[model samples]
Target: MQVMKFDMCYICLACFCIYVSGCERSNNRQIAGEVEGERIYLDEVDGMITNSLYEYLFAISETRIIAANELINLKVLKIEAGSRRISVDSLLSMEMRRISMQETKLKYIRDNALQGGVVDERNPFKLHPLDTPAGAEILNNSYQKFLRIRLVDELRVKYRARILLSRPQPPQVDLTNVTSHARGNLKALHSVTIVSDFDCPVCREAYPELSKLFERYSDHVRFEAISLSSSVTPPILFAECAAKQQKFWEVYGYLYGQKGYDFNIDSLIAQFELNREECKSCLESRDQHKIIETDMNRLRQVGIEVTPTVLIDHRVYHGPLTDKAIGRFLDDLFKETPNPGN
Candidate 1:
């Protein structure tokens, strides 16, 4: 298993993860390449990259933010150490002693040990070693590094340093025939299309909030769910068939309301008022799965790799949907765009 190895490195740079790859200041009009002697500009290549691989841009933007903040933290730490007339290393060593060994952070480190991988080897100075005892002295080394970051955080606030970088926006995709279950204000100004798995616990937990989003902004937003599941079949194929009868959302709520339980035919029919024989026939049909495949293929083109990917006005937001995040995003968007015909 690949791990963000538990390695201690040449301080500061390693602690802060200041090396951000795939970031550059480019002149848009510069000739990036030539395609059969026709000039291809930087902006053209950039636009293409952003469209097909938006996550690449997102990662660059995130690391750039981290690098920028760490730069601030470093500056603040230097100023504090200088004021105290001590070497920066001495200051760090002194401050790091205040960290407690029995904090909850150790558990987090252990939990996250298996999830790390080579993010970008552009700057290989920072290393995440395996958590194995044979790999490195686990506890002390990780805790010392933790203390360094914790100190960096304290110094950042103390010095009134803040990061002002904005995240890169996701590519906008114009979706058609993605789902038959499009709901809420059909003619609404903003449209939200969520592609997800009903079997996902996170997706289930978020279902009500998204439904409420439809209800709250029923006049301003249109909503839909494109069902896709990897380990299951009935819920995916069955829901799409139900969508033909405008019973998709009913089936959706029913499936999720089961709370990770296997799909039940009797309960589904009773709950959704679904026709028993018709549903059975449709669910059994190989053609019904084609509808699901069509939806998934359409979404995969827009980079729908994970469940519950929300596309608001075409920008992709991955992970479980949340009210605070979605609400704030909607508010900002509404502010940017005035009411229609205004």
Candidate 2:
């Protein structure tokens, strides 16, 4: 049995938003090169490589978050161990004995087996699994890893330790080609961008939660969906055609509401009151497919390769797509704090 791991990185942006950049913006505005007797500033070159810059900033922030947690835990460990007149290793050993992980894992396995489910011998059941199947001998190493994590969490609470690092600021996405499909407050400071394909199953499953996000933040947050189909899916282009009539969101909802991937063009026309001849012409010409190409090109420039990549406020968000997770993100984004450090 292995103990549960603790996440010292809460990734709480609200707690980490206290960054006060001392660097001058005038540096970026400094003239770099002259083109045809015209002076060129760094902003043009900066714009071209904003993706790499975002990645660099993200790396720095993530490293700071992780290293701060590690240092805080070490300090707390030393303090607690010193109070008890024991070495840090001895303190960890004592704490590890108190965790009921063995009983928990056995119960979990027993419950799954009793329910006639095929429990994977390789995953959570396996203690510190190697490349091969899990065995009992290697379990001690896995237990030790989890023990330290749990101990760190306990010490953090005892010491009221906090990590102080600001979250990275991502560059703004180019929204010119995608404005037609956008819904919500156009002037709102906060925005959500989803790169998705209509036929992708994961995209289909995500719409419900996305719908909730739209509804929940309808007042302040705008949602702009960009198609991710490399080639044309008729339904996807059809939605774009619908955008001309200001029915993109309606078509978007109708497409995702279906239980299966296959869509009927005539049914869509009938339901949405679109002109049959024009809709057919639009579908045949594939003119709207260019929107997808534009989306693809823009996403590539930003280093996104997967379907359903969600960017909130132009920052790539990699978190669970649940209401609670989104709520925490929103809270982090909108709430004020004395110091932004997590």
* Candidate with best lDDT: 2
Per-residue lDDT value at 184 in model 1: 76
lDDT of 1 by residue, 209-327 (tens): 88777767767777766776663377787777677677887777777766666568777767778788888888788776776777777776655667767888768864236776577
Q: In model 2, where is the ten-residue run with the lowest total lDDT? A: 1-10
RMSD of each: 11.7, 9.2
lDDT of 1: 0.66
Q: By TM-score, how accurate is candidate 1?
A: 0.52
Off by over 4 Å in 1: 1-167, 260-262, 318-320, 339-342
Query: What are the clashing pairs of model 2?
Result: 15-340, 15-341, 16-340, 16-341, 17-340, 18-340
On the 0 to 100 scale, the lDDT of residue 128 in model 2 is 39
Worst 10 residues of 1 by lDDT: 1-10
- Give the top-scoring candidate (TM-score): 2
What is the C-alpha lDDT profile of model 2 across 1-342, one tens digit per residue?
A: 111112323233223332212112444455669979999765665556655555555555555566787889899999999999999989988877676454354553464343232323356452332333433333434445656787788889999887556666675655565433678877677777888888889998988888888888777777788787667677778887777777788888878877774578888888899888877777776445665667677777666767887888777775666655666566667654311221
Error of 2 at 50 (Å): 1.8
Off by over 4 Å in 2: 1-40, 101-103, 107-133, 137-140, 174-192, 198-225, 229-232, 238-309, 316-342
